[model samples]
Target: MTEAALTISHLSIHDRSGAALVDDVSLSVPRGGVLTLIGETGSGKSLIAQAVFGLLPAGLSVSGTITIGGHESIPASEPKRLAALWREQIMLIPQEPSAALDPTMRVKRQMALAGLQEEAIKPALAAFDLPGSTADAYPFTLSGGMAQRVLVASALGVGAPIIVADEPTKGLDSDRVTQAIAALKRLSAAGRSLLVITHDRRLAEELPGELAIIRNGRVVEHGPSAGLLSAPQSDYARTWLAADPRHWPRCHRCCDMTSLALSAHGLSFGWPKGGMLFEDLDLHLPKGGVLAISGPSGSGKSTLGDILLGLRRPMAGSVEWGGLDIVAMPSAIPPLRQRYQKLHQDPITAFVPHLTFARQFLALEDVKSGLSAARDLPPLLERLKVNHRLMNRRPCEVSGGEAQRLALARILLLDPVAIVADEPTSRLDPVVQRETMQLLRATVDQQGLGLVLISHDQPLLAAIADEHLALGPRA
Candidate 1:
């Protein structure tokens, strides 16, 4: 048998209140093997990965023995020693690519700082299909998928012996996801050990090795990936696998298309430096309609949604809502602005980082009474499956999926006439994703609200969308 590259035994983690987050879990990754951890959001999957790298937040206590390269260390006792192994020995591809990337630095520069040689940077980006010009662009300018690829490229280029990728394919399209999997397979083939944490069953299935199904802070199922995924032993694992979007029941399209909620004509947009993304595009979202936009990374799916919402200007077109040219009106007017809302792809950037969620929710101007009232908040939280305790924590403290649900809840509270959701459920687990999409469909049906969705998830789009628009490279 091949020697173990990394081993964890009797691992447990606790939050500040002495609540166990990860409970007595043990796992091993042999050299040249891949180990995947699949579970629901906030089920301690990320906590385990954080503990492995000694990057857990302050006030969280850990009791764990992590062995790497034959050296064993207690996580709580020797955090610095574990952290010292970063870059050269182990690298982490974080869950939120936007937060992990440096906003001010160019892409190539960031890769170089990650220990990728200058000459290798171009080839690395190219491997992910990133354009040559992307090397000079700042992180803020890249699409969510582009940013994710950049992070993956940077981390993998460091040649670390062990890699812990947390939701590495979160926002990628089908093609890009396949590319990522291929890259990871190559790494394992070259004798590097990988510990991947994700909610994506497709990713788990592709990286066949050891699979551990975690639930409520414990390893409920552990076995070979092929056998377990094909026939899970635990009830929770069965439910999770069933929740895959591929198996989702097709949603009936019941929207009234008689009247328009949003429309765009002769739309054209492009970056000054990168040339045009899309042009002469026309779109319509009827009252209570669902229009989904899909495309490869950096194809401007989100940009199109932004144009329809009046958040951005198309170079040569007009966007109309309720027969008024919203493109010509000021975007900040309360009446118009409140009627149109957006759910950002990166929920972390959607709120003030320093403030708690409760404060942010309370600060929203109540459209009905012109006062901040959180009276309707409880039911919304319950419907979204968000715990009330999370409201007290700051944005950075919560999981990405939790923050996404909160963002949706906040938008729902406004009672908007339309919502432009940019990959809103990408961070959520499969089960929660189905629930949230169902809620959105119900809301649209009941309130006659229009929805403009941008996603790379083909199964999800197939299950939910009324009309689909696919964008691609300009001819």
Candidate 2:
């Protein structure tokens, strides 16, 4: 076996209140090799990566020995020493850009903090296919995929010998995924070690690596990448592998061609800088039909959503919903919302942070039926598999999966004639992804609602969408 580049022994992390989030887990990545740590949501995979980098949250207890190269082992308690080695010897590609990036700072300024000069930033951004001007944009102004690429570029900028990428492929499109995989492979070829923590099996299969399946904060399976991934010995591994979109069977639900639920005619949009995204674009979604829109990062998919929802004024075009032009009648939203709703990609951010899930649901129900909807909520929440007790907790307390389901439940309560979901499952685990898609398919069919699924998840779109509208480059 190759000599170890990064190794962790008996690592454990606990919350301030004494709850153990990560158990005694141990793993190693050989020099120039990659090891993917796979796990379901909340399985503590990212937490382990944080522990390795000595970036755990305040008041969390950590016990471990992290050794880099043949250097002396470093304990988690020595923050200064670990900080010294952080960028030069080891680096982290965080899962959520919101966490790693400073919202107040411009993207370029943030990269500068990592010791990247303007000259360095140009090449790095270009390498990731990001525009040079993107450096001046704030984190919130950038798309999720754009933010993700910024993080990747910063990690590469640091020239670390060892990289821990947590869900590095999240929010990326197919072309972007290919580029990221190629970049990581090149790094490995150049003798750098990588610890990739993800729930994406396809990405894992493509990267040069071994498999380390983590569950409940422990390493449950560790073996050769090809063999273990192709024929996983453990049930968790097998189930996870099967959840890949490639393995999913065709969805049986067919498209209904008779009635039109939504129509966009003569649509045209252009960036302020220059160039049009799409012009005279025509699209339609029949009642109870699924229209999946897909394309590369920065491609106008989400922009189209905003236009369709009347949130953005298109250069030219009218979105007709039930023969009414919502774009022209901004005052009609109150009643029109009953037949139109949106489930944003980051549902938690869309939710009222201070309000409990129950209160949020109740408030919407009250808007619909005074107080009668309260009697109907329990059964609906049960059908969605949402715990009643969780309703009392705020959005921040729920898992990503839970928050997504809750968002869906809220939309269902609204009884909309159609719903536009933008990358709804981008942040979920494979298991949750499957479950969420299945629920969406069933809900669309049963409720006879129009569904516009906007995502870069091609396999998922292929399996679920009745008709896919390709956006971007072609746009």
Candidate 3:
């Protein structure tokens, strides 16, 4: 048997308020083997990863011996050696993939941060089937999935023995998930240990080897993958098992039975020198239905949403809303669009930090130009589960989930025929994610509004969207 690369004995961590986030927990990882950490939100799976890398937040206390490399144990406390050790011995793959990547830096700069060569990134990019130019593009320019893959490549470039994979598949489509899992397996085959942490049960099942279930900061169960998955002991494990994607299959069952509420024919869009982000692409969203556009990062899903929302005029083709072409309609006629609201990829950037939700939603007029916006705001906020108290708080004062809810509420007040949401659930917790998607799907359905959900989350999309149009490399 291979030697254990990392071992945690009686590890415990607590936050500023003296609340224990990661209770006394122990785990052992053999070198080059795959051990997945499975749990739900606030389960402290990420706390374990953060503690390993000396990334605990302010006022947080940690105690434990982190054994690495031939019994030379380091208590996460030794700042100097631990910092150096962090850069070399144990590397971290962060929870937020986008944050790990710099919007300003090119891939070369990121490679340099991890003491790697820019030229060698090609193989890493290729492992995820990314184009050769992937290493040359900026993070903002890359699609969500591409940006995610780049971060993984950067981690691999660092060449650490143990990798703490934290929800690495977030903002990725199913095909990319396949690529990521296969790549991790290849790394394991190359004698590198992997600790895959996720709430995605299907992902845990795909990983070969043992599985450890963590709940409320402690390991509730640990054993062989199949043994744990087939018949979990703890209620938490059973809950996670129930959430597994294996129970849900049959791609796009919602598509066939639903009618197209909103659609585009011969839809093509482009810029000065680049190829069309969307070219002759056709799609549809049934009334009160979702149409998921799943694609690799940067494949024009956002552009397509903008095109459909009449935000960006396409170079060619037209978008039909209900019965009329929203894009080609004569602007001479007043009240340009009947129903459309857009929530962009970055809600934080889109929000006015100083403005309260009530004030923001209050800005919507019966008519954007001259006519009053047709709908009222109170029930819209209620439907999204945004509290009346939360309405008074500024965008910055609220959580990401709350801000997104208000963003949706603001759109809801517009009383549009469709809601074009880009990465709506990307950064939210799974439970919050499901709730948000469910709320939006329900709202759109009841209001007769079409939902054009542009996302990389397959399982979430599967539940809400009637049909999916695959784009980018996988398409």
Candidate 4:
């Protein structure tokens, strides 16, 4: 048998209290082969990747043998040795592209720092469908999908022997996802081993490799991707596969056009240094309705949401709520702002990392009028199907799905009339994504709340949106 490029033997990870997070997991990736890990949120798939790269948090304890390129070491004991392997032998395309990039540096400089030669930066960006102008842009100026492509381009450009990509297509639209898959395939074709962790079923189906279905820290099933995806042996694996957004039943909700909750007229917005994103755009959302926006990366989907929510001033337009133009009323901003809320793509950023959710809720009650008298946390938690125990933990201690649900709960406390959800489930697993959308739909139905959902997932939009708006490139 040919030697494997990477191997994990009897790997187990435990939290500070000795409770196992990953239990006796073993896997291998042959030279030039791919090993894809599919599981629900908090399933320990990313934890295994972190252990291999020695990126696990300080309190966690690891017991495992990770062999990379014929060199063996215990991840728990040999921190420096594993650190030495980064970039040259292995590179991680992290799940959170925004966090992975440096805010201060330009994209071209970051690529150069990732071991790409100065001359190679433009072609590398172009390979990921990023324009030459993207090379000079800062990370913060890029959209979530744009940042994801930048990270993928830079990471793959390094020519590492082993690449561990966690949710590499997290924020990309369908077309960019295809581009990313092509890049990964090229790396594999070049004889580099890959360990891809993702919740994207399309990626799993397209990338031919060994598949491992992880659940609650255990690898419940492992086989060839084609065989397992076609005929999975385990029940959990079956459920996971069935939860893809593509398999979801389409929503038949009809839009109610009479009572407008929010409306935008002749909206035009663009950055001072940039060209117009959209001009003379109009939108309408009735009470208890969903208005979904979709487009290519950097096509102003999120920007339009920001304008409606009053986060950004449109060069020319008015946003009206309840028949009143809120955009023109700067003095009413204090109370009016509470009526419109936003659920961010990354919920972790919406929360304070060090503060517990319970404390944050209390803080919100203190500031927001009538919030304390309106609702309690327990009922909201129950409604969202979140565990009460999670309220005691900080945002960083919970999974992305849990944090997002909690963010929703926080927004609910404000008793908002409308919500602008910007890819709220982009990072979530399929099952959790479905659940979150269901909850959002329920909220819209039950409370007569308007929702402006910005997303790249077509199936999800087809499943829940009452109205669809497709944005194009800036005029």
Report, for all candidates in order, the number of backbone clashes: 0, 0, 13, 0
Order candidates by TM-score, high to low. 1, 4, 2, 3
Give the candidates in order of lDDT, highest first: 1, 4, 2, 3
Tens-place lDDT digits, model 2, residues 1-475: 6889998888888755566668888899998899988877666787788777777756568888888866788886666777778877888888778767899999999998886877899898988898888898889867788889998888777777899898888889988888788778877888889999887767888887788988777889998888888888889888887888877888856666668778889999987773688889889888888999998877788888888777788899888887887777767656777778888877778789888787787787557765444687788778766667668678765556567778888888777788889888876778768877888888888878888999998899988899989886622
Candidate RMSDs in Å, in order, are: 1.8, 3.2, 5.6, 2.0
Off by over 4 Å in 3: 1-3, 13-17, 59-65, 70-81, 245-266, 271-274, 282-287, 296-298, 309-313, 317-417, 423-437, 456-463, 472-475
What TM-score does structure 4 among the candidates reach? 0.95
Please write out the lDDT profile of model 3 over residues 232-313, one tens digit for every residue. Answer: 8888677656543334443333443255567788887665544666678777777766778877766778878877777778
| Tens-digit lDDT string for candidate 4 (41-84) | 87788888888888876667788788887776556446677788
Q: After superposition, how far is residue 265 of candidate 1 from its true place, in Å?
A: 1.1
lDDT of each: 0.86, 0.81, 0.71, 0.86
| Candidate 1: pairs in clash | none
Model 1 regions more than 4 Å off: 331-334, 365-374
Could you tell me the lDDT of residue 375 within candidate 2?
80
What C-alpha lDDT, on a 0 to 100 scale, does residue 277 get in candidate 4? 88
lDDT of 1 by residue, 1-475 (tens): 8788889888999876687878999999988899999988778898888888888876678897898867665564468988888887889999887778889899888888899998888888999998787889899999889899998888667878998899999899999999899888988888889999998889999997999998889999999999999999998899999998889888767666669888888999998877898989888898888899999988899988888887788898888888888777755434688778999998988989888898899888645455444678898999999989888778877778888999999898888888999999898888888899999988988888999889999989999889999999532
Task: Please give the lDDT score at residue 251 for candidate 3.
Answer: 32
> Model 4 lDDT vs. the true structure?
0.86
